[model samples]
Target: MKTISKWLALVVTVFLVLAGCSGGGDSADSGKGENGKVQISFINGFTGGDGAYMKKITDAFNASQDKYEVVELQEKDHYTKFKSGEYDLVVIHGNNLETYKQDGLIQDMSSVLEKAGIAETDFHQAGIDTVKLDDTMYAVPLDIHPLTMFYNKEFVQEAPKTYEDLVKINDELQAQSKDLYALGVPSSGLVEFYMLMIAAQNGIDLEKDGYLNFAQPEYAEALMQFHDMVWKDKVSPAGLGLDGEFQTFMKEAQEGKAYQTAVALTGPWFYGGAKEKYGDNLGVAPIPQIGSQLAAYGNSHTIALPANVKDEEKLAGIAEYLKFMYTPENLINWADGGQAPVHLPTLEKVTAEQEKYQIAYQNSQQFDDYVSAPQVYQFGEQIRYMNESVFSKVVTTEKLTTDALMKELEKATEMAKQIAATAPQQ
Candidate 1:
């Protein structure tokens, strides 16, 4: 009896030791906060005014929940900081979805969204499509920032809805004020986005064989059309780089200066400043069709989880936060950042209240036609920084011809091929 009792005691002691070891090990609970909520470190590049707006949403989400505490950082260069993998969630541009996914930085979000009770059909089709790569969903979209047309309502009675309408508006503006430019065309900055719009409308296939199809005839035609906006029509002044066009548009008509730029093609980033300058005279409209088909330069801001954040509790918290932010009523406030929330229901709410969100409401309608960029690794680095874009050359080159422009495109095409080659196929 004594021998049996001693064996039982030994077995019980061993079992307790095993239990203690399992209890002390690292796990999803390690990230829990003092309040017993999982702490989700979220990061993004929404600096300046955009940061402030996103913070409000984050704060509201924190206030509305108890299971998760999201601590967010806005670095403007957040991508660099995110490389440390300390963050669980990050906001990225729709076009960069493929780059992040291919690099194994972000995870496929289809299952995540499913667990969160969010459906692909719950979001706008364009927004969903923007973040999808090769049929795999990557992130939940937050907002679409399309290039909107800003005009002076004081000078123009109504916003132009088509190419002919723009020409007529420009002619009328010229007649009324000979010194003012009818339109402003940025020679830099937005050149890439502008090309996307032009490329799509001209039926230029965006990507083929993992490279840009700039070597096509339709692309040349697109360049010619863009050149004509400044040279042939003489509606826009030549060589108005990004700053020149925006500054001219925001110039005061007061102080004995005639309105220099009656119309401008810019993004939501400039709307607040323009409104402050123009007051009620600021008019927002879709960047009317420059080609036979409607295509806008735009992309969505999406929320994604980093691949390293696999804690089940933390994932649940992230899902809660995503669903909360994506809620129609919750996301409607995103318009404060001069962007359209990609949640279709939220956009409908904004469009219904146009007086409060004119630019966002109008631009929201244009997202459906936005030229979605194809997968090209570090697309901005590969294409956006190139000094010799077809648009810039067309607008600035003196006595430029199609043949000469084709040669320029050839150089850019080769450079693009080299860049695309570096992108690994997933």
Candidate 2:
């Protein structure tokens, strides 16, 4: 009898110990909050005013749900951190989606969309198309920021309706020696984007058979037009980089100077800052017809799940969080942060609201027509090199002709192709 009793006691002790170990292991592996709510982190580069709005949305999601907790991390290099497993999801520029998808750093989100009950058609067609590579969805687009025209209402009663009008305004401004120009052209690599916009307007395809074709006549014409604006017409201040142009415009506007930039070609993100400085004097309009058709440069912000996150529960949590973030109500909050909503329903709501900057919102609606620059990996660096080595010379030095700029562009294209070839393949 004593032996049996002792065996039973040992068995009970061993079972209890095993159960406790299993419980601890589950808790450690799950990384759940109290009550088994799955914990996930979202990484993004919303360090400006948008960060506050993102935080509010995140907090609202946390409060509305008990099954998941989303923690937001604001970091500029979100992709690096996401690859390190620090975040379950990351918001990347729409341009980077292709690079990330090709490298297998981010996973196809079709399953996530299905699980979240989101159809591809739910978002703006342009935004949806931006994140799709051959029918495989990789990211959910959040917003589109298109380069639009910001004109000084005090200087110009109506926005320029045509390219000739823009040039005439600049010519008039220069005649007055008013220290004001019709436009502030940024020489800091933005000239490449401007050229792309103009090329798109002329129906010139920038990419052909996986190669860049900037040696085309349309590109040459675009280059000359930009050069003339800076050097010959002197509409743009000589040697004015992006920051220099922005600072000059903002300073003049803030000081109520008679001679301020008459029109600025910038993105919707600048609307908030410009409105703050110029108040009602700031006007927003679609980029005037620069080419045969109206086209401008634009890009989007997107949310994507990292490829390293293989845990189903964590992925489910992420999908839920994204769905919550894109709800019509939450998207309105996103718009309040100066982002143009990408969800179709939210866009409809925003259009109806009309309480915010109506001109900016209306201009944003035209993003579908905007042309986005090619998003090849390291392509931005190649463009920057072209700007500094080739385009800058044309604007600053009278000796460098448009033909010379075209030759440099050809070299840049070759270098870009080499870089893209070496970049990670899909």
Candidate 3:
């Protein structure tokens, strides 16, 4: 319900371009030239209605300062273009950063910050961790996207506080012929790996120090529960196509069929839909815990000045702007598109606008229970595979088990290592 100023919106508009499309104007104005504005190029993967909101944020920033200008490019082609020396700065998901860094597209941020006299200790530990490669920083953290649970108030007034509670509610709903269930986890091979993070909140690790941990009893137990949810309970929909799963899950939530879902496991964009659809009827909370701790999916949108960028002052301005973005005021203003901030201190302070975001924001705190999978490239893909493969074996395939799940995870981890090893060195 918060309205963004026009200038900030413009920046958001230009940064949301996906990697393969050409949309929007190719406007380059750095506040100098004829109009006396500074121009900087920004690229991101917003690519949807969220792009419009991002643009609003950009427009606001541009209007506020004449020292620098930002030229927005559809980010779909940014990585390719960034490697080719096309932009001044880029905002992108941290998971793909390894590939970029390995290829020498983005400069090591820790080195840049040191050269710029910025201290790493100043930023949030978790936030910094999201931007790391073997403990070396490569990007500035902008936001941390984590899984949040959104459920229908009309169908289920009391949201589950734990995973077991969700199962109980699902059973109750089924017995009552409410035909409502708990969640519609994604069906992708990577999904299982993501689920491991959920399992980790309970002390399960699928891979540790580059070794397979899926064979652990805790890991297997956690996966079996997921298998039970999909197969034995039949809480989730069957034969739902992957492409439409997100939409279908949201639709069911809106229609009061399913009670909850793990959609948008990495960002806040998912909550925007429910807010628009259900208003006060929706409830957002950190993902429920399974055993002794809580965990949720976590990923990051990283900030990095491109190697080709030469304007020192402009880069400084951006650093200042990054600082501003983390403040409660600016963060609340720009908490759309599912990208939640990683600053715990800033998050603790709240306002009415932010309270709406709290539904998703609060749950993101549990992300530490599971290392931001994106932080580990192989693990991220492994999660995607885990979620899908586990769900399929349980729901669709009906042959999923603890041992089977372990093998799948081991195989995926090996594949991830292979990808990392073969990746071009930066």
Candidate 4:
């Protein structure tokens, strides 16, 4: 009887351990929705006013069908969450696609896109290209946001068509003593982005084969032009940071100040604030042709799937969700949050159907000709640091010469190369 009691006790302990392990496994798996709906977790960093628009879309999608339901995880560092298998889908910056692919973190979506009947030709070529690597597509482009020009229509008759025109306008405005300048330049890292855009327009390559090459004459010329704008032309102030410039423009417009800035260089997201402040005076246009050709700095947001999402049913559900989101009927909904759809068909539809902000939509379409800066993984911060250090000094203190800036760029490039070399191989 004593031996039988001991055996019963051991059996109970083993059963309890097995049950606990099973419970842990079940908790890690995705839960089913009512009537066997496949629940998919989506993670993104859209915690601003845009979040509401995203939620609207998600709710609409949920109501449109009963097979799948999307759960949003809004937070910063979405990639980290995705790695933990808590989310099956992520919306990330297009530039990060390459790095994620190299790390084998994202799944190749060519098959998924094909299954959803979405072709590469269906999207804006520039946007589609951002998510492709060596003929393989890994993500779907959601929207294109480019650096553009916004002007006060009451002061400026029309947008400046060329670089010379910009200077002339500034000179004329300053002479009128109407308190208006030709342009309101921001003293921030974005100045470097503008310089890169000009360099690209001139056919100068700042990055070549995973290396930085700022020794080109075109780069120097672009820098010289920026320097002239600040110091020689005096059209823009010396020390107004991005926030200061934005506030100055808004305050001047609100007060009906005749001497307000005529033009401001910013992104599409600025439309809401500018419209609120300027009312009917706000005018949107592509950034003026600063170099030999028309070019602007641009980037995109993309939807990507993680490699861990291997379930066929889940993939199908995700494909359907994406298809729904990109449908022509729903694409225009993104405009509510100031996002320009990356789908070419949707863009055309918006241009024809949406008249309230037609110019803003048209300007966003110009991103097809825009140039994206180099996106070196784990090295972007270092490059930005170098750019800010050099550009801020040049714009504010006028102390860094072109030669000194070049030397500093070379050093930064060397440091970037070293970091790249030590990065883990995919």
> Evaluated with lDDT, which candidate comes out highest?
1
**Cα shift from native, residue 67, model 4 (Å):** 1.2
Report, for every candidate in turn, its global Cα lDDT versus the true structure.
0.78, 0.74, 0.58, 0.72
Model 4, range 1-426, lDDT digits (tens) per residue?
Answer: 999999999999999998988763321165575557888888898887677878888889989988888877787776676666556788978766767776778888988888888999998777877787677788998887777777888778888878888888888877776466777666673565566677777878766655556655557667666667778877775666754445545655333333357887776676788988778888777788878888877667899988778888878888888888888777677766778777888787778765664544856657668676565555354356456665665577665577776776666667766655654652
Model 1 whole-model lDDT (C-alpha atoms):
0.78
lDDT of 1 by residue, 102-150 (tens): 7889888887798888888877788887888878888888888877789
Cα TM-score of candidate 1: 0.88
lDDT (Cα, tens digit) per residue for candidate 2, span 1-426: 999999999999999998888653322145686767888877898888788988999999999988888878898776676666546788988777777877788888889878887888888777877888768888888887776777888778898977788888888876766577888777663565566777778888877544466667667777677678777776776666654445556756333233457888776666778888889888777788877888766767898877877788887887888888878888778888888877888788888876683643766657778666575665555456566666666566655676777787788777767766766762
Sort order, lDDT high to low: 1, 2, 4, 3
C-alpha lDDT (0 to 100) for residue 415 of candidate 4: 70
Between candidates 3 and 4, the one scoring higher on TM-score is 4
Tens digits of per-residue lDDT for model 3, 1-426: 135577778667767655235553322223244576556677876676566656766776777776766666666666666655466668767666665666567676664565545566645566777777777777877666665556667666776777677777667766755435566654652353346555667765454544334445566676666556567766665554453334544664434444434222323456667678778876666666655676665566787766555566666656655554555555554455555666555455432346666643565455455355444433444345445454566456666667776676576566656555554552
Candidate 1 Cα misplacement greater than 4 A, ranges: 1-30, 252-259, 385-390
Model 2 clashes, total count: 0
In angstroms, how far off is 281's CA in candidate 4? 0.9
